[model samples]
Target: MSSDRLRMYLFSSMLAAVTAIFAQIEIPLPLVPISGQTLAVGIAATILGSRYGAFSMVIYMMLGVIGLPVFAGFAGGAHIVAGPTGGYIVGFIAAAFFTGLFLEKTAFTYKMAIIANLIGMLVTLTFGTIWLKILLDLSWPAALAAGVTPFLAVGVIKALLAAWIGIAVRERLKSSQMSFGKAA
Candidate 1:
């Protein structure tokens, strides 16, 4: 493979690994455990842009679904996805995809990244909340209560941090001509 393609492949794989690692670091909550998954997603999207960022999440999902110990609490397999929080797991892909898409379409500014990551978080929250309601036969309020509301404050904070950190990291990488995840 060409050097650039090789770098992308390696970087994407590394991001996938990072996502898995972050998933394990969580604070147990009522329905869903707060985890570092989104932080990793933000970093991946900002650094790799949309396509590879989404691809990295896809890799992480596939690994988890295939019974690897990559999910929160080191749990994995298809069954994990069938549980209450499954939707959020699936939503990670959408989050990464949209976050990356936004970065790709606009200049890589912190403001733009924050907006993109927040939007991505919303996409994730929507999917998870809906799935939670259906899975538990909950009223909309209950579902929102269980899945979305609690996450809002932290989500925004994470989005901002991800944007700042991701952008800064990307800038450093670019200055060094070592942007492993930058699109060729």
Candidate 2:
């Protein structure tokens, strides 16, 4: 691989590791525990943009599926990906990709990042709620209450914080003449 590709791969791997670490910091909820995973997902996209961000989440999922304990509460195995929260884990990929795609397509302003992250967050909630409903055999209302409502406030906070931190770090990197990608 070229130097740039190697750099991106390495960085993506690091983000994956970060996601795993965040996953371990879990607050036990009824079925799904709140974790720092989403925050890391947004941060990964902010730092890596669309392609690499997606790549990082893919790597993260792979690690979890392979029983690497890279998921929330250090619990990992193929079963995790096949359980009620499986859809949420899969949603992580979508969140990272779309969030990065929006930022990549826009001016990377705080406003734009927040919008992107919000959309990304919705994607996650939709996927996760639907999956949670199907997996747990519950009505839509139960799914929404169990999987969505409790998460909205915290999710918004995480997204905004990630956006702010990302913009600040990106600005610092740019000012220092550091390349955040192959093009730079």
For model 1, where is the 10-residue window of minimal lDDT?
175-184
User: Candidate 1, TM-score vs. the true structure?
Assistant: 0.93
By summed lDDT, which 10 consecutive residues of candidate 2 come out lowest?
Answer: 175-184
RMSD versus native structure for model 2: 1.6
**Local distance difference test, each candidate:** 0.88, 0.88
Best-matching candidate per TM-score = 2
Q: TM-scores across all candidates? A: 0.93, 0.94
Put down candidate 2 lDDT per residue, 42-101, tens digits, no spaces.
988887888898899999999999999999988899999999789989999999899999
lDDT (tens digit, per residue) of candidate 1 on 79-140 = 88999879998898888889988877887899999999999899899989999999999999
Candidate 2 backbone collisions, by pair: none
* After superposition, candidate 1 runs with Cα above 4 Å error: 179-184
lDDT, candidate 1, residue 65? 94
